[model samples]
Target: MDGQICCMVMRVNLDCNSCCRKMRRNILNMKEIEKHLIEKQQNRVSVCGRFKPADVAIKLRKKMNRRVEILEIEELPVHYEAEQEAPIVNHYKYY
Candidate 1:
């Protein structure tokens, strides 16, 4: 999924503050992630980045030693600015 951005929401068992902290640390270490949000009350983790959804789920499961359910996966549009061309001007010399 190169050059593609996506958001993945997963349900994880965040029973305690330590669990949330561990999850936060692991997510922070992932270089591909642009940002992340954790809802402790909902026991959900939302990650936005350029990585595959399944890969993240697997990594979280392995690292947390907990069951992670993929709740949703959404492909986000990438916005790029168009390059502007420089205007040309004619110069005249009079003798």
Candidate 2:
């Protein structure tokens, strides 16, 4: 492998948009992550994507009393392709 490491944005898809909002809020509430988010907003942050399938499945199993398995985590939003095609480059530049 090359010495340089590859990185991608971290994203977790929940069952619904409410879950996504809740998770985003939770992430924003974290002191450590808050700082990183600030940098991320500026597009100056470096990070790698992670998807803890086992952990998520365990949580679901405990809550729903049913088995769950996470297939993968997406770095960008599910609608990333459409967003990327947006003409609003200015908004991202400021972010």
Candidate 3:
């Protein structure tokens, strides 16, 4: 195996117009889940992702229940193609 390590990103379904509240909730959940896995599996990992608030991470680490060390935090933008939608919809089926 190569010396480099691989990391996984939680899948979040959202569009450009998604509400801020929803986005925040998804990000928080991602971090919490990843942290739990790190503790359970005892794997060394560093989490770097965009759109995550520092305060939320700090608060979660403070709990010290599942994690005692603050996992490495870095800001990196996550980009992927969102599911496409039909440009137009037919109303005949609605009747």
- Candidate 3: 10-residue stretch with minimal lDDT: 1-10
Quote the RMSD, in angstroms, for model 2. Answer: 12.4
- List candidate 3 segments past 4 Å from native: 1-36, 43-53, 62-67, 78-95
Prediction 1 global C-alpha lDDT: 0.89
Deviation from native of the Cα of residue 69 in model 1, angstroms: 0.3
C-alpha lDDT (0 to 100) for residue 16 of candidate 2: 52
Error of 1 at 89 (Å): 30
Pairs of colliding residues, candidate 2: 41-95
lDDT of model 2 at position 95: 30
lDDT of 3 by residue, 7-93 (tens): 333222223333334334443576433332222233332343332444444544443223424435433222321222225666686
| Residue 50 shift from truth in candidate 3, angstroms | 4.9
Clashing pairs in 1: none
Ranking by TM-score: 1, 2, 3
Which is better, 2 or 3, measured by TM-score? 2
Off by over 4 Å in 1: 80-95
RMSD of each: 9.2, 12.4, 12.8
Per-residue CA lDDT of model 2 for 1-95, tens digit only, reads: 12222232333335555554554455454332212221323222222223333443354345434333333333444454456467853545543
Residue 30, model 2: Cα distance from true site in angstroms: 0.2
Candidate 2 deviant stretches above 4 angstroms: 1-13, 35-95
